[model samples]
Target: MNLAVFPRRGYVKDPTPIESCPAFSKALGGKVNIFIKRDDLLPGCAGGNKTRKLDFCMADALAKGADTIITCGAVQSNHCRLTLSWAVKEGLDCHLVLEERVKGSYKPEASGNNFLFKLMGVKSITVVPGGSNMMGEMEALAARLKEAGRTPYIIPGGASNPIGATGYVSCAQETLQQLFDMGLKVDHMVVPSGSAGTHAGIVVGMVGNNANIPVSGINVSRTKADQEALVRKLARETAQRVGMSGEFPDEAVTCFDGYVGPGYSLPTESMVEAVRLLAQTEGILLDPVYSGKAMAGLVDLVRSGYFAEGSNVLFLHTGGSPALYAYLDTFK
Candidate 1:
């Protein structure tokens, strides 16, 4: 996937590290070699997978003459934080529509990304219930902003659209290049599958490049069937958007939804355990939501003999660790 052909804004200055995690692997009983692609270390207010996606999304916004940016996400959404962070740097006003996924979850005084949203000086924020029509809301906001004599661009939740996913396609290329330079070939790679852009991007990129690496996703908020379908559709669309020619296998878009405890944004035992294990062993932190659930899924798969013995697995650590401060009771 040659992302250079696409319009992009600078976000990631260099390739984030693909570091070996011998201690983490040993702690998991050494059934397989483990590594982490530290997308969490990406350059931004705080590093995250969204930084890559925004590189392309903001570029499109700029090309469209956007003066203000509008987007939607959960109250503590890392995407919202990063989007606002970049918008401030880009000199564009940002407006956020936060979904209170859990009823009564959107407290004005809540910490975590919520506080950052205020500190970042977002133009405005409208809190809505979970499952709201995010696109419709963003469109309405755009209309109002237009009436006020401002141009607005809307980035869908998670920035998971075909355009934003280009960042992940670029990442797929980067990952393969790093592996080649190190003389390593990984068997499987896992990432948190939320809005499906990251998962779809990697799937399309790997298939297009014939890297032969399977990219899997762990669902943070949806069922397996739903998440897989979304990822599959977006992967096909992304392949078309990038002008890649190939028949992507239907089985390539895999997702696991077992780790999403009671509901979205709620704490779970597996997540708590996984967060502590990784932090204690490898000195890496995962947020209470996405990456924690993803690590839990990866850990369970490893313990259940899901991977071939001695096979190598890579975890895409899509950073959101700062949200841990908002979920202090989970750790306590």
Candidate 2:
């Protein structure tokens, strides 16, 4: 697999750490050994998994001679935050199309990523209703920017396209090398599945490298069937993009939808517990939207004997802890 074919901006210089969490593991009944991939500590204004995707996406945008960027995400989106941060660093203007997934959720006075969006000097922000056609909205914004004599590039929500997904393919290779050096073998891997790029890229990297590690996605929004199919499709596309040829197996993609209690960005009791547990136990913070709920799923699965006794499970901490400020009431 030649990821060199894809242009990357080198946003992430050093590999993120893989650390053991004994206290958190014991809290889950000590049935499985828990380790975390700290993509949460990845580089950006406030680090998150999106930086990995943006490392490639931003490079693609620059390579195409874009002087401006247009992307879409839910209100208080971590993806949007990181996208804007990198654009600022790259000296490019950024525009945002935010979807109010819940009615009246977009507030100018809101904290978290929204506040950061303004502090970082986004060129403009457009809020639309829930379930809006995000790509169309971005294209419309892009048209206006083009008319203004600005070159604009559109990055889909969460940077989940083949280009962005290549970042995780590189991540998979990095991880495999790390595991080999540490003499550790992870039995399974869990990730938050939203736009599918991170999950898909990891799947391709693991399979393409013949590492034989199964990647499980904890859905932040979609159903089990839907998220699994999306990851599988993107995995195939990412593999092909990196010049790998083979059938992308369906069994490689797995997801659990039980943890999404109400819907995307809504608070759940399990999520609250999971967030607080990791913070208190390991001094690791997880965001309310994605990583919190994902940790909740992993906790439940372990408590229910989902994995074999003495198994080692790796959890990908795709960061968004900065969004925690917006959910203060939920945690309270």
Tens digits of per-residue lDDT for model 1, 1-332: 56788988878779999989998999998989999999999988778999999999999999999999999999999999999999999999999999888989988998899899999999999998888998998999899999999999999999999999989999998999999999988999999999999999998888889898988899999999999999999988899899888666779899999998897889999999999999999999999999999999999999999999998999999999879989998899
Question: C-alpha displacement of 298 in model 2, angstroms?
Answer: 0.3
Q: How does each model score on TM-score?
A: 0.98, 0.99
Number of clashing pairs per prediction, in order:
0, 0
Model 1 TM-score?
0.98
Which lDDT tens digits does candidate 2 get at residues 1-332? 88776778888899999999999999999889999999999999889899999999999899899999999999999999999999999999999999999999999989999999999999999999999999999999999889989999999999999999999999999999999999999999999999999999998999989998888899999999999889989988888889776888879889999998889999999999999999999999999999999999999999999999999999999999989999989977
Q: All models: lDDT?
A: 0.92, 0.93
Worst 10 residues of 1 by lDDT: 243-252
**Which regions of candidate 1 fall more than 4 Å away from where they truly are?**
none
What's the residue-level lDDT of 324 in candidate 1?
93
Error of 2 at 72 (Å): 0.7
Candidate 2 differs from the real structure by a C-alpha RMSD in angstroms, to one decimal, of 0.8
